[model samples]
Structures are given as structure tokens and as C-alpha cells.
Target: MSFSVNKTIAQINERIRKGKAVVLNAEEMTEAVKRMGKEKAAREVDVVTTGTFSPMCSSGMLFNTGQPGPQTIKTAKVWLNNVPAYAGIAAVDAYLGATEPSEDDPLNKVYPGQFKYGGGHVIEDLLAGRSINLKAQAYGTDCYPSKLQERVVSLADLPYAQLLNPRNCYQNYNAAINTTKRIIYTYMGPLKPNMQNVNYATAGKLSPLLNDPLFRTIGLGTKIFLGGGVGWVLGAGTQHVAKPQRTERGLPLSAAGTLMLKGDMKGMNSRYIRGLSFLGYGCTIAVGVAIPIPILNEEIAWFTGVDDSDILMPVKDYGRDYPNCDFKTIQHLNFADLKSGEVEIMGNKVPSVPLTSYAMSLECANTLKSWIEKGDFLLTEAQEAIPAG
Candidate 1:
């Protein structure tokens, strides 16, 4: 990411000066010069071509093409080098300050009448195939059956006999019971099923009855029930209550439950959760690129060895077309001007070409030059750089 302005310029100058010069036969000097011009053109083209391909050399390549202004080149270089660090810093900040609730925080609400613990249980049940039902209650409506009615109704109107039913009686017997036996169900309800005293005893036994061959074929989970169909059932005598499982859509819970579930908690229990973090890492990098920042954009272009054509094109359009036009394209166009001691981009001094089109030209030039220098007209030095597959 670091760059020395003086060092870069010096290296460029030295390369140009040290490059071998062509000597031609006197009889064909015209032809030789033409050939030399073509060769030089080709060499210059090669430099332009490879420069475009060179990672972190976008600004350098652009200069060879005579397109970008000095300011644009400078700005691009600065931009490219700074993006990764900026993104890294931002990522660290986000990772440290992510404010969502932790897995164990019971207060974190996911969905109405749904607690994080319950959501996890639901996931586990879905995996293990123990009977699971999620009853979604409309707010302010009587969703709980009559068993929970008493909990919602005022106890002041309850008769002594009705309040003192032995099965429902409690320490605050009179106050606790009501005309009806319904209970108050909140979004934060526990994962355990709510049932009347009579229902509770029978509900536990239902699991065993459901193990019958007739019921075993249908899946006994929340999704199956909500979707209005029976699904495959788990084997009878499955002692363990199901635990939560991870999926792409996230924890199968209400909104409140989702909030209560922690990313770290998933990391601890599931291998799938670990993979999510890696996926997030890649997403974070992509987000960093999408964020608007001038220097960072340039830095990306430099690292990729591509021009910030989106930014550079307007600047290049104002420049005039030159005779040897191959080099004056893309980010390289600007760099070409810089090498010629034109510190300023004035009027129409820059060159304009389609980003893709210019890239091809630079690529051809570099390929030709590489072939001449490396004695392989068909293969580029870059191609040679690659190890045999």
C-alpha cells in the first residue's frame, strides 16, 4: 500500500533510459526507422499493455497512454493504496461495535410469543422430529385456548367453587383463578408448550401415541403444522428434546427470538455457523468496495491493475487524439502525459477510448513487446510467469 513518489518516477525513468535501442542498416534506414518506429510503437504498446495488467501499476500504465491528468493519476494512486487499510479499519470497528443482542440475553425479543430459547428448541425439534407446534397469537386477541382463559379474565368476578378447583388451585387460589382458565401468553413465552392441567398430563403421552405407524409418516414440526399438513414423524421414545439447528434463513424463530440469538453462540455449537463468519468476511470486503471513497477506489484499481474508468474517462475526453494513439487510453493515458513532464491536464490534452477497447490495445502492445524481448512472439512474459498447469 505504501509508495514513494520519487522512487517510482526514478524507476520508470531508469527503465526507459536503459532499454536497448534499435540499430538499423543504412540502405533500409527509412524502412528501419519505420520498423523501429513500429518496434518502438510496439514496445511502447507493450509497456502500456503490461502496465495495465500489472497489479498496483494502474497509475503507471495510465501515464503511458497519455490520457489522465496529473491530478487524476496522483489521486488514483492515493486512492488505490489506502482502500484496504480503510476497509480493514472499518471491518474491525464493525466487528467490535456490532450491537445486536447476545445468545443468552433472554430479553432479546424475536417474534411475538417466541423467545430465543424456544426458537432454538424448535430448531432442535425440527431436526429430531419430536412433535412441535407454534401457535401464532394475534395481539389483543384470545389465541390461547380456554385453559388459559382464567389467567386473562379478572379474578374479582370468580366464584369460590370455580376458583378452588383442586386441579387448578394455587397459593393465591382466589386471585389466580378466574371465570375462565386461559393463561397470559406474551411474545417472550418459553419454548415449553402451554397446556391446561388436564392437557399437560395427556400431552406428554401424545408423543408416544404419535409414534404409531399411522402418525410416524407425517413430520411433526412447526412448519408442517403451520403449512396445514402433517410431515414425517420421529421415532417413539426419543428422550432428548431437540436443540436448535442453523440454516441460511437464520434461526427458525420469531423476530424477538432472532434478536436474542447471538452470532457467537452459533459459532460455539454449529460448524455451519463457522462457515457463516467466513462468508460474512467476503461480504465485508465487497461492501468495502461498494462504499464511496475516492482514494479507496483508486487503490482498488491499482491493485487490480485496472483504471478507475468511471472517474478517469471524463478527464480523458477533454484531451486531443495523437498520431500514435494506442498508449493513450484508460488510466495509462494520464500516466503517459505525466512521463512527458506535463504536470497539468489542461483543455483537451488527455485521450479518450472505451475502457475495454483501450485495455485490449495496451494488452496487444505489451504482448508484442514481450515477444520481441523474450524471443517468443506468441507468448507474453506474463504467460511465461505462470507455472505449467
Candidate 2:
């Protein structure tokens, strides 16, 4: 007799609660699938977790501060530690963008100004329990008399603080190179001229979206590990292209899918959420995100079995092509080739490095796996699947 495996997320959760669900990280699942085949592996494995740590430029936070005084002042302008925030929301609510620079910083006044601090750093400082300088300007009115507010505030002082990122955890991204004579600074870090260096951002095989390329198990309302805390997928992210150029193995060659994520700042860890600034580039935040894949059948198992060699990245010239909105690719490379430290481009050998940290990605996967094995975390069924183009 033969049995086909098809497990529901609820069943997996029950097994997890009973301390019997077989959970593995993406790396382990790959090896298991190799040894036992997809059929057998799918039946044995309950869940496979995935992770990625990369600079998500389109990420930020939302906070609501209580009425500073007795008057109900509507904030026209808001600044947190010299960094401007969008205060067009409610009375005292504001949204801080990660890429927003501090007003005090002389940006571009000097060539390639070092954006040492910005919104990302503000978020980090708040999470670290440091005091923040809050200043807001408002036009005084009859009902709301207060015009200006300034004071020191900590994370706990705020009524609500949420990490509401518009986009994070990209499915797959580009390998950036500079074809110009001079070095160029970008979010991918500085790229040497003449394609001397190649920089790509992704956890490759360990990436959450790559392990489930088709969004089978990941979607809106799916529970995830975000910034070292439990978060939920809000929806498909901005600039999300559900369908894009792909290889024979069905891996996207460009930035195909992205995620809109939200989590509570109170429950987050500072280590997983970091502030980063590239030399010539502006400010951004490095967010740690992970997703758990529940193995429902052989196909899901096969998806999780993808190796680094199977995931391909498109190499685009940041010098001109990318800046001009040209999606033209000079070549395609696999993580296996990138991890080797160097790859050949146009018959010339160039050094390759990952902008995302593989060690942190591994740690995220292991941490999520442990949460499941210890019955602290349960897999969630996506209420609605992500949109497919």
C-alpha cells in the first residue's frame, strides 16, 4: 500500500503542540529531500523554515503619540531627533521612513556625504531604550491652542509603535556592477569600475521566497519572523511584479515578488533590526525576515529542496542600465558561482560578494525552527494568496 501526503497547517500545528511535528530549516530540508526523495520527504517533514537578512530600502515605522497637552493639536510638521516624519495622519500620529535623512546632516553639500544617522538609527535607538528628541510644529487654532511641542521621549513613552514596512523580503534581486570608469556608490555598496566587483543581495537557497517561489504557502496575513519578532504579511509589496523573466528551473531572474510586512516594535530585538548607511548612498534599514513553509505534498517538498546553484541572479550594470530604468542584463549567475568569491563577466574575472549576511540568515532559519520544535510557534495558513501577475 502507498500513501500520499497532504497535511493541513492546522494538523501541523497540532503535531507541533504535541511535540511531534518534524521541522527543519531550508538547508536541512534540501538534504532530506536529496536522501529520501520528495515523496518520502514530504510525508516526514511537517515544516521547513526559511530566512533572509538584507537592506530593505522601502521599510519604515508608524507611531501614535498621545496628546502632549490638554489641547488637541494637529501636527503639521514632526521631527524625531532631527529626522522628518510624515505627520499628515491623525492628531499626533506620524510615519518615519527609513531612507529619510536628518535635517542637520549636510546631505550632498559635500560630495558623497556620510549619512551616519537617519530614521533607521532613530528606530534602533528607540528600541534600545534611548531617549529621543521629539519636536513638532503646528498652527495654533481656537479649539487646539498649542502650536509647538518639544520634549524628550522614549519608546515606552509612545502610545503605539509599529514597524509598518511597505516592502521587505524580496523574492530575488539583481547582481549590481559598474561599467563606468569611476567607482559608483549605491544601495548595493560601492562598485568598482570596469566590473571589477559584483555585489548581490539575497540569502540564495535560504531565502524565504525562493524556497516557495510560487507563493504557495506565503501570502497576506501569513505569520512570519520579522525583525526578531512575530509579524504578519500585510499584502503584496510595492513594485511587486508577480511574473518576471525566469530560468528553466522556474527561478525568477529579477526582482519578481516582494512583501508588505508589519510588526510591533515592543517585541522586537535590536540585533535583527539595524541602521545602515552606504558611503555615497542615502540611509536605509537592514531588516531580518523569515517564513515557514508547511510541507503539504511532494511539490512543496520539491520547492523547498532548491539549492543555491539552482537560484539565478541577474547581473545589471548600475553605471547606466539600472539608473536609466533599463532591465537589460549583462549575464546571469547562480549563488554557487557568487559564493565562490569570483565570477567571469565579459571574459574578465570579477570579485563577487553578498550584501546580505548568510550567517544571520542561517541563524534566523534555525531560530524559527526551534520555535516550532519547542511548540512556541505554529504555522499559519495564508488567509488570501498573494496576487499573481
Candidate 3:
């Protein structure tokens, strides 16, 4: 009878031991699960929580309860546990078909991959204050040319020819002015003339001539004289030899009696004819005097004047207006009406919680999976029973 009683007592003791072991294991498992939950919470909070997006908890929690409510530790604990489970299920559902093994199959026996959280937030921040070089992209070129040169030619016969014959000047001056303006406007920014389209070389050659001091100084009458008969005479006169005269009397001698004229005679005649004879013989003579007029310099000065007086002043005034135009001046402005604490999220003001929550969840899940594979925590009975374990 005593042996029987001893045997029965031993059986009861064994069952108690097993039960104790099971309870201890269950508690450890719960603690591990809770640790994972806390980690996930922290990650999600880090990723999704922004100063702008933080749920204004005037009551000391996420939701708005104006009274400064009491702390409920139990409620928080419950929330922590539930969030992970809910997140896992939601993730599984969201990535239903995309997973290698279906969501319904089983939890992954293998550990998680690397954590990939906060990427979405990083991307959002990058996009917020970004700028781009639009001119470089659009024009496939650099900045505008700051230096430019233009020539204004005052033709001798333009006005008179247009008045009298009209047909002599085939090119319309008005049309030419308009076209030149268009060219100036078109090439106002950085532009390269298409040599293939026109005689860019001719334009280049004319540019230097336009900048010449003599060209700018020459008047209409001077240009007419230089370009017309006078020019022809001067060119032809370089080779002309004056015929020497021979006379019986003490007068101008005949050709046979007189000495040969060594220097250019008709050239001197042409210069005299053109009213530039005072500028000595064989001197470098430019008929139509050009003067360099700095068009770009004048334009830049004008632009600078406008900027200093108008643009900069107005811009500065606009900036100052922000500080001067305070709400205090308005009679209806009331401080009490402005409820300071977390205002209701609505309309366009409602913040888009960047996909940080989802990303962090993925990271947490991956971390948990890694811990489990690394044997950081013991598995369930069913999991332990698997062949790989």
C-alpha cells in the first residue's frame, strides 16, 4: 500500500514539473515576443513620426483628448502587443501573391534579411528642397553671353535715296531694323551663329570693323565720298604717272623737258578731292572714320540702374512686408480662438504619413526573423519538432 502511494506521488510530481517547465517556457516566449513588439514600435515611430506628422496628443497620448488624461499603462501594453500582430497580417495581405511562399503557408523558418527602414523618409526629405539646373538641361548649353557688340550704321544715301528714287535701296531699312532687333533678341542669350546657314565669317569680319574708331566717327557725307568716286580715284591713282609738260617759255614745261613725278599724283588729287588733304602724304588714311561705341557697356549700365532702383528695392520691400504685416493689427484676431494643441488633420493640411510605417514594419519583421534563426530565443513546440531544427 505504501509502495503504491509512493508511485502515485512520483507520477503527480512528474506532471507538476512538466507543467512548471511549460509555464516558464511560455513566459520566456511572451517576453521575447514583447521585446520584438517594442523594437517594431520604436522603428515605426522613428520612420513615420515627423514634427509635422506627430499626432498632437494634448492629453499625453497620440489621440487628442483635451483634458490632459491619466496614464493608462495597461492600455499601452495591450496596444504594443496588438500592433505587431496587426502589422504582420496587414503586410502579409498587402504582399499576398508577391511572397515566395504564400501568406497562409506558414511563418518563415529561416531568419530575416537585412533591415531596410527609413528609406522612404530619406527620399521625401531629398525631394522637398531640391533644385535643378534647368538652363543646362533645356538649352543643352551654358549661361547667356554677358558681352555683346552691335553696330548702328548711318548710311549717306538711305534717307535721300528712299525719298527720291525709292527703288535704289532694295533692302527696306524698317524691315532691316526689325530683323536686326530680332537677331539681337534671338542671340540675347548664349547663341552660336550657324555658319552653315549663313556667312558667319562675313559677320565676324564686319564685327571688328564696326568696333573701329574711324568707322564710328565717319558721317554720312564722308562715307559717300569715301565709297563713291573718291575711292575709285584713290585706288586708280596709285599707279598713275603725271605727264610732264614741255614749253618754250618760262612756264609749265613739256613732258620731254620736265622731270618725272616720283610719288602718287592722282592719289593726292583724290585726297584733296575728298577734303582730307591736311593729313600728310603717304600716311595711313582711313577715309570713313570709325569710333568704337560700347553698346554692351551702355546696356549693362541701364540694367544695373533698373535693378538697383526697382527690382532690388521692390524685392526687399516684399520681404519686409512679411514682418510688417502682422496679425496683431487686425481687430478680430483672438488668441483664445486659436486652439494651440494638435489641430484636426483635414483637407489639404492633412499630412501624408510617408511609407515609413510600412518600411519599418518590414525591417522589424526581418530583424525578428533573424533573431529566431540565430537561436536568440527558443521556438514553439511545433517549430522545434521540424526536421531543420
Candidate 4:
């Protein structure tokens, strides 16, 4: 016998009352599945925590830098650390994206701007309680007559700076390599030529959506640890493509589900969430997210038993350009072989290292476990699974 949402919640609440609810992180749940099997594991483990720490370029933050001047300023332009914050909104409200580079960055003459101090880095500074310079301009009006405004601001001075990312955790990702004899700078970090290096993302076996697979227990309104603070799965993210090919185990062979999460940037820890400057490339934010999967049924338990071998991703040759690059020919390999630190590609043994931080992912998972143990967090029934596209 297994459980429904209400039944599982009741058991969890009762256990909490007795100060003995069983909680396990992804790694622990995987082990419990092997030792106790699906049935026992389903009944014994209340929640399974999953984490990912990687650069999510789709991330951004919205801030309420309160009206600083006596005259209302309908900000026509906004800049935070040289990065343009979208001023299309109201006067003092703007959104800064991780990948958004500054206007002055192009003058550096690099093919790709090394946005060392862009909006992403600005967020890190704000979290660190460091003062960041903010400048805005608006044509003077009859009532709201404010031509220009500028100031230094900190997180404490604002109402809240919310990190609302349209796409955060990707279901899966490619392990990239450059076959041509030329060094390339792409989003997956700099690629050394002639398959000299392989950079892979994704938490592999420990990824959240992969653990749930079919989105059975991960959906809208599901509470998650996002950017070091609690957030919810708002809805299906852009390009949440339910791909055609999937393993017999039901996990996608390509990137499938995506998540849009938002949380208060004020309460988040700077350590788990960070910003980066890719030397010749643009800026990116390394966001940490954790999802707690409720073991509501035997099917859920079966899904949670998934391992590195069950998850596979493409090894793309980034040397090609445009539409051809989109349809580039390559092999799909299991995360198990990728985790081995080497993979045989075209008879050439290539060394592979994860650009994403698995160690930090584990730490994020463990941190969520402590929250559950301390009764600081509780699971909410996922509103609805991500439907087939």
C-alpha cells in the first residue's frame, strides 16, 4: 500500500508532532531504495530533497528601489553596475538579468564582453550588503518632474529585491566539446579545441525533475529552495519542451521540463547563490535550487530510484555554427560514464569535468534536510504536473 497527497501529509504531520518525521536527501533516498526496495522506501521516506548549483542565464531580479527624490521620476533608463535594468515598469521598479551585459562592455573590443560587473554581480553585491550605485534618467513632466536621479543603495534600504527567474533548473543538459582546432567561448564556458576539454552541466542523478521524472510530485505551487531562499514552482517555464525521445525509465534523453521560480532576495544566503564573470563571455549567475519530492506512491518511489545510468545527455560539437549547430551530430552518453571523468569520443579519450557544482548541490540538499528536521518547512501537494506539450 502507498499514499495519496492527503494521506501522506497526515502521516508527515503526525510524525512531526512526535518529532520523528523521516526525511532523506536524494543520495540517501537512492540508497534506501536499494536496501529497502520501493515499497519500504515509499512508506519510510517522507520527503526526498534534490539540488542543482549552476549558471542559469535566464535568471533575473526585480527590485523596489523606492522613490528617492521629492519629484516622481518615471525612469526612462536604469543602470545597475553598468548593466541595464529594464525600466519599462514603473518609476523605481526594474529587473536586472544575469546574462544582461553593460552598454560600455562592447568597447572592450572582445568578441564576447567579459561583463565582470553586470547585473548578476550587482545582485551578489546587494546580498553581501554592499552599496551599489544606481542611476536613472527620465524626461521631466508637468506633475512628475524629475530629469535624472542617482544614488547608492543596499538591500536593507529597499522593500525587497525578488529574484524571479523564468527558467532555472533544466531537466537535463549536454556535455559539450569542440572538435575543430579552434578555441571557442560559449555559454558552457570556454571550450578548448580538438576535444581538449569537455564541460558538462546538470546535477545528473541528483536533479529534481529527473527524480520525479513525469512531474508526478513536482508541479505548480510546490515549495522549493531557490537562490538560498524558499520559493514556489510558479508555472511551466519558457521552452519547457517535453521532448520526443525518453528512456524506458521515463526520464528524457534531452532537456525536458523547466522551472520558473521566485523568492525574496533579502533573506537569501550569498554563499549558495552567486554571480560569475566568464573572461571572454558575458556574466552568469550560479543559482542553487532544492526541490523536496514527497513519496506519495509506489510509482513515485520507483521514479526516485533512478541513478546516473538512467540519465543520458548529448555530447555536442560546438564548433559548428547556426542551424547546423542545432542539429549537430554527436553521441548520447550516460551520466555514469560522464562521472567517470573520461569518455571515448570518436576513438579519442576526452577528459570531462562538471562545470556545475555537485558538491554544493549536496550541501544544498543537506541544508533542506535540516529545515525539514527542524520543522521549519513542510511539503505542499503539487498543484498540477507539467502537462505534455
Candidate 5:
């Protein structure tokens, strides 16, 4: 059966009017789906909350760093606590990429995994009320001329430090392992060679997009709990693949739909959004995101009901370049099997590591519930449907 957006909105409004809007968290919804059945669950449940906490390499922060340093310094190079921040923009404005490593000690050939600090970590430090050393350099010029600048900056010091993530919650992701003999530093984290370990991002069955499957209930303008504060879906994120191999339920057999998210970094704390440095690998940002899914109809209910067994991810070789073309040779495993801590690949029980934090994700969902209950947030419809791949 098809879902009606207008009808769903009315149902939600009525429940809100009656002060009985039933909002269920991810764990609760999973059980509700099984016990109440899709039809009944759809009829009763007003909202299904989904959450995930994972490393997003595409995340960055735009900062206003208080005032322009002594003299009108047009910052050409910027670094915060050894990590690089983009400072080529207008004076005093800067953007720090999550994956940017320090110039002095970057993720390189000699000691690839030795970096203890990254752009993400610098952000975390600044959020924790710690002062970060800021240094910038520029060529002496007739206007806004300053060759050097240095100071300490904190979140309190900057009026604007917005979390502008070009990409965040991926629709899906692959489980990566190394088939080669050498260890590989990858975006999915270090992959152990010879199928030693499989690393996967996303909370698997608990991810937001995984529940929605099709973006009917989630799209641009969907308000989400992002890095501890409210954020909105701007549009399709970078590398968005609208279509991928799908199962009978329309859930992808691999990574699919993605979201471009933006939020105010000033209102956030280090508790939810943390900066991380991968040994020998570059820096990456870990963001917490959660959304409320309206049970528009039975189909949505069924989609929300998808459990670990319903989701499958391809185990690919991270040793090779990304978008690995040899996907046919990759083994697909269900989240249920993957969640077992180990999965038998080629008759060998290989340990699996979740790159996403389930605990943080649950916190995000519950936090959103509190927001809805407090009437601080509401569901919104996308102005336009997300385009297909």
C-alpha cells in the first residue's frame, strides 16, 4: 500500500492535539514492528527515531575566530594545535576540514598511523572549553598586510563556528577488509590484511536511512539532531548514490543515499561531536545524527521494522582503490551475522569492527524524543524530492 504525506501529517497533528503523540526510539520500534505487526504499528506509532554515530571525513567547521589578529592579516596558511585549517578565505574567516592532518606530522609513508592529533581533535578540544593555539601566515601586502599572526582561540572566542558537513550520514557503507598481505590505511579505518578483520561504518540496522530505505519520509528540510544540536538536511551530499543493489524491501545491498547536513557548532559540545586522528591515516570527524521517521503507512512501518537480518553489506577489499569494481567477488553478510562480533569468511571466522558508535546513536534518538515532547521540534516536508542516482 502507498503512503500519504498529507494523511500522515494530519495524524501527527491530531496526536499532538490530544497530547498523546506516540514516539518510539529505534530499539522500541524494532520490537514494536515484530510484536504489533506493520499495519498496527503504522496506525499507532506517530514517529520512529533513528540514530547513528560514525566517522565522517567530509565534515568541516567554518569559524570566525573572534577578531582579526594584530594588523589586517589576510591569513594564507592556518593551523590549530598542529592540525591545518583552511585560511585562504577572507580575513579572520577559516574552515577546518575533519580529515586534514598536521603538516609537521601528517599521515605519510614513514609513520602513517602515528598522528595523535587531527582536525577533528582540534574541534573537540575547542568545544571542551580548551584554548587552541591559532597561527597564520600571509605575504606582506599593501592592503590587509600581515606576514604572521598567532593567538589562542576557543569556542567562546568565536561567534560563528558552524558545523558544515558536505557529507555525513551515508545511506549505506561497505564492510572493508584487506585481501593483500600488507596493512592498509583506509577511510573505513585500517583494514587488516588477508581478511583478518572487517570494518564497517553506520549503526547497521539502527541507521536512519536504513529504516527509511526509500527517502519518502526523509529529505531536504528534515530536522535532525546533529552533533548535539538541531540541523537540517540541505540536499544530496557528495558521493550520493541514489540507487544501489537492493533487496526485496528496497534496502540497498551496499552503501547508498547520503545527506548534506549543516548545524551551528557554537551550540554543540564535545560530548557528541569528537575529532579523531587515525594512526598514519588522516584526520576524520565523528558526528552524531538522529532523525524522527513518521510512520506514514504500512510500507513505512515495514521499512521501519527492518531488523539486522534484513540488512546486508558487502565485504570488500579496502586495499584496492574505493568504489572497488570487483564487487561481485565481495562477500555480503547480514547485520545479524556481522553483529555477532565475527563472521565466517571463506570458512575463517574473522572479527568484525563497527566504526559507528551505537551508544552515542541511542543517546541522539532519545535526545530527539525529548525535543519533540518539549515541543521544541517538529517534522517538516522536503520542498523537493531527492533526485535518483
Candidate 6:
């Protein structure tokens, strides 16, 4: 017997409101497809949610400190907890990026994971309701007489706070290994000499972009779970390669698509928005993000059913290729091999570790599923599709 099934976002939202929508995480969706076949699974499962948590350097927050008076100040410079924030906006608005280092950081003396405080830490402290030292400087003007100001403020003190990340949730990333005789530090973490270990990031089968490879379900204005709060997709992220080399299964072999996201920081949880510092590298934020895929057709079901073994990743040497901006594909491997503890490289087996947290990803997926099941979350049609390559 042949099966033909199709659904719409409106239909799914109605089913969710009536407490009849069948939702599953990406992992469960993969199994359901395998057991019942693609067409049947597509007809039965209304949604497949995915999640990922990892160090994303292209993340930051924008906030506005309430003006004390009309003649208080027109800010020309700003710092939060001694970390410099971009004050090019309105009088009291600033943007603190995740990779921005502390003003007191001695860059030359910094080592891997040694430099602790940065923009990421500041953001975390604010989210936890901790007071931060706020300072600003400006030349006195006719309407704003104050030249400088200093105070202690928490998240509540700020009239507005929004997390606006330019790039997050990389579709797929490279697995890094060092081919040199000395240890090297990179955004992927420290790689030992001569390929002793390899590092990669992604939630594997549970990654959002991996589930929606063609950018069909997730697009501009689509709602998502971000840092334990609700968020929306702004647009295509910086360095977004819409069309990259792919396998027959439509999985990219290297870094491909990305996302631009924004959310209200007041509602974010600190656990899902963490600060991280790498030895010999810089500081960044580890963000937890999740997206729900509405199964509108059989094709989307097949895309979400991809397993770890079926997806491929390009192996690159961080010590040489990465530092030189050379994207040389040293080898090709799969997440199944990496997660199994080790992978073979040049006739030698090397231990592999994932920088991305699969456990946290699973937790996020379950959280989103619960929200949908409780009728607290509803699907939205994308106002505009993300640009496809």
C-alpha cells in the first residue's frame, strides 16, 4: 500500500490546542521513521524538535540604562563590570559582545582557560540578579550636563535588555586535530600533538539546522527556544553558506548554514547562557537553543530522520590548516565513530571528545516538547523564508 499525507502549520497548531498533536524529539523521530516507515511516520508525527548547546563566539546582548534626567548625560563611552561595551547607539544604549575581554585583562600573560572574566561572565552575572559596576564617560552638552557617571546596577535596573546573537547554531562543524609536534589551542579547544585527540561541536542528530537542512521549517520570524527563554529567528547569520558541498543524504560535510537570533534577556535562564574561557584562546558564551520542525510533508520527515551514522563531518588540522585559513579536508568521519570513544586517523586510533553537550541538547528538546504538549507553545508560519543557497 502507498501513503500520501500532508499537513500545515495551522493544522498542527489546532491539534496542539486540542491536545491531539503527536510531537517527538529528533532522536525519537529518527526511530519512529525507521519503525513505521517514512510516509506513515510523516502522517503520525506532527512535530520534531531539536536542540544544541556549545560555545558560540558570535553572541551578545544589547541593553538600555534608563536616563536619570533630561540633563543627566549623553553617553560617549560605556563599560559594564569593566568590560567595554559598544555605545554607538542612543544616549544610554550599549552592546556587550561575548568575545569582548575585560579591560583589566593582560592579554600577553593570558593562557588557556586562565583569563576568567569577560562579556560572557558579565551577562551571566546580570541574569543571576547580581549587581555590576556600571560606568560611562561623555563630554557635557547643553541638554546633558553630566561629564561622567558611575553606579552599581542589576538586570532589573536596565529598562531594556535583549540578547541579539548574530551567529548561532552552526549547521555542522569541522572536527579539529593537531598535526604538529606541539600542542595548539583553538576555538575547538586544545588539541594535543600529532592527532592524539580530536574535538568537534554539535548535537548530532538532535541539532536544529541538521534536522531542517534546506531551511524549510525554520526561517525569519520563526519562534525558538533560546537560553531558556522564547526567541525568534532574525535572519541568516554572518558567514552563512546557504549552499555548501553535501552528501547524497543532503548533510553538509563542513560548516554550512547558521542563524541570527534575538530574545528578551529578562526572561533568560543563566544555566543555558554560560560564560566560557579557553586556554590560549578567548572567552565566549555557551548558549542552549532549540527549534521545532513541523512535519508538513514526507520530505521533511526524511530530513529529520537522519542519524549520526548517516551524517559526515570533515576532519581539519587546527595547528596548520585552521590558523592559515586553509579549509583542507584531511579526512571524513561520522559522529557515530567520534562518540564511540575513538576514530582512526592515518592508521592510528585517536580518542575523540565532543565540545557540544548532547545531554543538555536532549534536555532542551524535552523542555520544548513539554511546552508544546501543555498547549503553552504554538507553531508559527515563517513570515519570510531564510535565504537558501
Question: TM-scores, in order shown?
Answer: 0.13, 0.96, 0.11, 0.94, 0.91, 0.96
lDDT of 2 by residue, 1-389 (tens): 23388888999999999999999999999899899999999999999999988899899989987786866788889999999999999778999999998888765556547677789989988888899999988898887678888889999999999999998888889999999999999999999998899999999889998888888889988999988899999889998988887666567888899999999999898889898888889899989888999999888899999999998888999998999988798888888999999998889899998899999999888888899899999888898999655
Candidate 6 global CA lDDT score = 0.90
Expressed as tens digits, the lDDT of each residue in 1-389 for candidate 1 is: 44221122233233434553221111122232234443333222212111111000000000011112111111111111011101122111101111111233343343332222322232222223344321111112233121111011111211210100001000000001011233432111111122211100000001111111111111221011100111111111112112222122111111011000111121111111111011111100000000000111222112112222111111111112211242232221222232232323332232211111223223323333443344222111111110101
Using TM-score as the yardstick, the better of models 2 and 4 is: 2
Name the candidate that leads on lDDT. 6
- Could you tell me the TM-score of candidate 3? 0.11
- Give the per-residue lDDT digits (tens) of candidate 5, residues 54-151: 89889888887654656777778888887778887887788998887776764453675566567888888877889988888888787877888888
Query: Order of all candidates by lDDT, from best down to worst?
Result: 6, 2, 4, 5, 1, 3
Deviation in Å, model 3, residue 286 alpha carbon: 86
| Cα lDDT tens digits for candidate 4, 161-250 | 898999978988777888778898888888898999888898876788889877877788988888778888987788797664788878
TM-score computed on alpha carbons, candidate 4: 0.94
**Candidate 4, pairs of clashing residues:** none
Model 4 segments more than 4 A misplaced: 1-7, 105-112, 321-325
TM-score, cand. 2: 0.96
lDDT of each: 0.18, 0.89, 0.16, 0.81, 0.81, 0.90
- How close is each model in CA RMSD to the real structure? 35.0, 1.9, 49.4, 2.2, 2.6, 2.1
The lowest-lDDT stretch of 10 consecutive residues in candidate 4 is: 1-10
Total clashing pairs for each candidate = 56, 0, 18, 0, 7, 5
Q: What would the TM-score be for candidate 5 when compared with the true structure?
A: 0.91
